[model samples]
Target chain A: MAEIVLEGITKRYPDGALAVQDFNLTIADGEFVILVGPSGCGKSTTLNMIAGLEDITEGTLRIDGQVVNDRAPKDRDIAMVFQSYALYPHMNVRDNMGFALRLAKADKAVINAKVEEAARILDLTQHLDRKPANLSGGQRQRVAMGRAIVRDPKAFLMDEPLSNLDAKLRVQMRTQIAALQRRLGTTTVYVTHDQVEAMTLGDRVVVMRGGVVQQVGTPQELYDEPVNLFVAGFIGSPGMNFLAATLEQGSLRTSLGDLPLEDRVRRRLEGRDVPRDLIVGIRPEDFEDAALVDERHTGHTCSATVDVRESVGSDVYVHFTEEGGPAGTAELAELAADSGRADTGMQGHRIVARLSPATRAAEGSPLDLWLDASRIHVFDPATGINLTHPER
Target chain B: MMSHRNRTLTGWGVVNVLVVLYALFPVWWIVALSFKDPSTLSDGNFVPRKWTWENYHGIFQTSEFTRALINSIGIAVIATTIAVVLGTMAAYAVARLRFPGKRLLIGMSLLIAMFPPISLVSPLFNIERVLGIFDTWVGLIIPYMTFSLPLAIYTLSAFFREIPWDLEKAAKVDGATPWQAFRLVIAPLAAPGVFTTGILVFIFCWNDFLFAISLTSTTAARTVPAAIAFFTGSSQFQQPTGSIAAAAVVITVPIVIFVLLFQRRIVAGLTAGAVKG
Candidate 1:
């Protein structure tokens, strides 16, 4: 097994196009690290650089403490599962899996044993004689994995290997892959645009934007403490809502109301000389129906007029207008800076709140809202970076 | 409804009949002439008074026809083989490799194909003289590649490109070298294109008459086309008609037989990935 380390790794095209920059990460042996980003956000480019498919423009890449900057993919002792699976159309499943071993000139018995092992792991024993074209999408994906597995490579480089599968199959394969990787304990670097997959599969996830590393941490860490507005908006399902708020004396003020700071949060913001205006991050689930807001967290409650209500069986989400945040904040850019929020003192125009299933909040109703202030994330409106705990 | 449909069917029937006649008339005439006696051939009618195999027997008895037949087959096979191999490599590179002038290389190869063989025959003749192979099979094979290479590469390259890159990458991860990956993954996928190219190149090489006649002056190196000219030579035939028709039948028979035997390969995917065949 290999512990892959990328130090200041960057890729720049001949036309001065930057695909990835200063990408530093150390994936431990047996760890599954995921590179997550939107399309063209350099996740694939980074994966390709690691796979030796693309040439790196700067920095060093090491596998197991050996600098592999000039090494070929084969010499790197790595196996890659391509997004397309890349199964040989003419070869049967067994031959496909055995291709690498056979290329290594392993004994026939060894090849057969390993091929059968990989096939059994993938539950592909019965289909060993079938060609790739005859296989289903999931089967093809398994064969790709099996091809990588049979090699017993130092690490597994998966380039969105499940992107081609249908939704339900993708989830099923996703878990199966994670379980398989856990069993094998091989170092794996999986690249994908799906945040859910990254969150669920990666031991430590790296969030990227514009070819730059945004944050690298556990999914929970990113979700609870996003370093910037980009990570805050990017990590969660519905994403954290950003509203312009004032860093008043011992409290933050929005058009909705003054949310009194909790002890822990107050301590984080106490010594910092933050600008008067700031971008406050509140997760959708942190906002509950104000009518249902218990006295325990009433200090953080704000009143809002509901606009849209969606019932999703287990929970209800209410989109509403608040009285004290930025007025008509639509673009992500307007909330990126403290100074640019022209209507910061007017009202928070739009808000999405997750209410308890028992509480019903209808459109046109002016309902009191409560925040789980202990979970409230404060970011600088100017830079979109969280300012409440700037040190960390 | 039955009557209207019957009328439509009859119209199609007439059109098909006209097309079939247009296609088969010349072939039927050739075959009929081949069976004709010298007297009947000179009479110049559709049907022969009597059939004879004497003209066919004459072709076997003569050394000129036998030598030309072997020479033609040898030249066609060699040219087709060379064309297929070179074309496949060129096509694979253009299809998959990311070299600086990849597109330009493909474009130039195809652009050079637009130069007619007849136009290049004189220059090739000079080259042939320099190489001391003016009347040999090598000379014909060399010039024939100029015609068939472009088509072969064009056919096989597109097919190679159509194969997903995943298989090759999978091969690489499987520990196969790039060359091995190509052999194991790309070759099989490109088989149909190679087969199609072989058949087409063979047909073109076999039917080539211009360079064959102009370059090769002797019976030892002359192809069937040039050899057949002897049957109609001024001094040889009394009327020069029946023997020429007989030689024509000899020439057409092998091509028909070869096409029928391997019709599947040519038809299965000759223009499978072609935008317009």
Candidate 2:
């Protein structure tokens, strides 16, 4: 295992476009770090720099405490699994797995033993002689994994390796890859655009946007405590709901209703010139069916016609529209664009609430939703900074 | 309605048979003429009046025909080898690399491919004479290779482009140097395309007549097509039709055999399914 450190790693194209800038991270040994973002955010470029596939523009990259910016990929001793699998079409599974050893001039018996062991681990022992063309998509993916496994390199770099599979196979391979990584205990730097993959696979998720690291934390840390509007919206499914709010006195007024500022937030805002316009963030799970809420707790309540209702066996999600005016900010706009939710002239902001499955919610009917106001987030409208974030 | 479809099928069948005959009749007639008896050489019928081995024997007895056959095989093989090797390198660059003048290089090759070979005969004839290489095998081989290089590059480059570029990256990550990556991975995948290109280049050189006739003056380096033109009968007044036809049939044997032997690979190369959708 190897620990990789990127100190101010930057990638500047010859045409003067900066693809990645000031990228700094220290991956501990055996840590699974995921770099995730939408397309063209330079997540792949950053991974390539670590693998020595792309040249670092103006920073140092160190693997196991040695600077390796000029080292060739083969010399870096890292194995990479590509999005396309990239298996040799002309070679059978056995040969493809043993190719690296053959190149290194390993003994024939050693190569065969290693390849056979990798094949068995991947459950590909029965198809050692089959070419990539004859194998199913999942089988080809496994061969790619087997090829990487046989190398036993210092580290592993994966660039969306499960992207090309169908949804069912993708889920299956996701767990397999995680299990394999844990068993091998290899430090891996994985790049993916899928947030779910980032959440499930990474020991620590590095959320990137516009070629910048917005936050770096464990999946649960990022989910429960996003630092800004972008990370707040990007990490969870049915992403965090945003509403424009106005702060007056010690209370915040939003379209959902007025919520009393918690003592911590009131203290943070005390003796300061607070911004009048704010954006309130609430996650789907923070909302509950009004009837299901405990009588001991005071919950902020709102009423709206349910635009749609989905019963997913475990819970029901109610999608409704509100006149919150889309929480206009640069970060929210970028997040909306990344999620393909921008520029359809959506009349108003859409908010999703996860409630108890027993709730008698139906489409075109008004529903009472009780939100945990104490858990609500307040952000400065201009800067997208979370005003109520404890760490900030 | 079924009868109407049957009539259409019959009409297409007749057309196809006629087309096949139209293409193969000349080759059959040449083979038939090679076996015609000397007495019936002037029969001028579709079917030979008499069959004999006299014409084949007559051509085989001449050292000039045998020498020309050797010249044709040697020159075509050498030219094809050189052209394909150079073409594969150039094609790989054209398919994969981005350089300042790549488009210009492609355009220049296209220009040479379309230029009339006959137009260069006179200048090449003079140049080779000045170089003291005229009527030499080197002279014939040079022009053959030069003209065929463009064809080889175009065909091979198209094949190279179809290869998934990710395989190279995968090889590098698997601990292969650039040279090893090529020898162990890319070269094997490119073999079919290279073999197909070699056959095409050899055929072009083998069938060339304009360059062969203009550049050579005697049997010293004359290829098969040129050698056939120089065949003469026993007497100055007699026609050499039978001998010429026999030589023509003899020269065609190698090409037919090559096509038969590599027909499957040629088809696969042309329609290679290197990458799945």
Q: Number of the top candidate by TM-score?
A: 2
TM-score of each: 0.90, 0.96
State interface RMSD in Å for all models: 6.9, 2.9
Worst 10 residues of 2 chain A by lDDT: A264-273
Q: How well does candidate 1 score on lDDT at residue B163?
A: 75
Please give, for residues B89-144, the per-residue lDDT of candidate 1 as tens digits: 98888888878988787788778788877788898888888989999888888878
Q: Name model 2 segments beyond 4 Å from true.
A: A267-274, A295-297, A343-346, B1-4, B269-277
lDDT per residue (tens digit) for residues A25-137 in model 1: 99999999999976777999998888787889999999999999887777788999888777666678898788888888999999999999999999999999987767778
lDDT of residue A124 for candidate 2: 99
Clashing pairs in 2: none
**Which sections of candidate 1 miss by over 4 Å?**
A296-298, A321-350, B1-13, B42-51, B100-107, B232-237, B257-263, B266-277
lDDT, candidate 2, B1-277, per-residue tens: 9999999999999999999999999999898888888778788877788888898899889898999999999999999999999999999999988889999999999999899998899999999999999999999999998899999999999888877888888888888898888777787888888888988999999999999899999888899999999999988988888999999998899988988888777666432222332
